[model samples]
Target: KNKYALQLDLVKDLEEAEARLAEVEQKLDPVGDYVEASMIAAASAQFHNVVAQLRILNPNVEFVEDGLDEDKE
Candidate 1:
């Protein structure tokens, strides 16, 4: 029973962390045009790193790819 409670607590912590991350992303979204692109690129790189770590930690989980082009040969 204690292990189950710990697991639930960990899941809650993960959810809160994700929410805080989204809040940070929202705050960063409204910068002026001159810096927005660079900021977004940096943020994307950081997000990718986090995702890679998550994948390593949860090897059984699969991630879906987006924006694949069919025309490219």
Candidate 2:
């Protein structure tokens, strides 16, 4: 009974914390956020291209990222 009560209290606390985080995230700096997102996107594309080129250069080698095959399984 005490354990169940503690679990319920913890869940309620987590719900409150998540609500606060959502409220704070809603107040982000718009221009900074957009610029940061764009930079991340550019970097991701460049990384993807490099990985593709590496695959082409070593066709027989099955890399961990060959088909983004690391964490899928």
The total number of steric clashes, by the backbone 3 Å criterion, in model 1 comes to 0
* Residue pairs with backbone overlap in model 1: none
Residues 1-73 of candidate 1: C-alpha lDDT, one tens digit per residue: 6999999999999999999987887677655564665767787777778878989998999976453312234
TM-score, model 1 to reference? 0.41
Mind giving the per-residue lDDT tens digits that candidate 2 earns over 1-73? 6999999999999999999887776677534686677777787788789889999999999868555523232
| Per-candidate clash tally | 0, 0
Which residue segments of model 1 deviate by more than 4 Å?
A: 1-32, 65-73
Q: What TM-score, over all chains together, does every model reach?
A: 0.41, 0.48
Model 2: lowest-lDDT 10 consecutive positions: 64-73
> How big is the positional error of residue 58 in model 2, measured in Å on the Cα after superposition?
2.3
The TM-score that candidate 2 achieves is 0.48
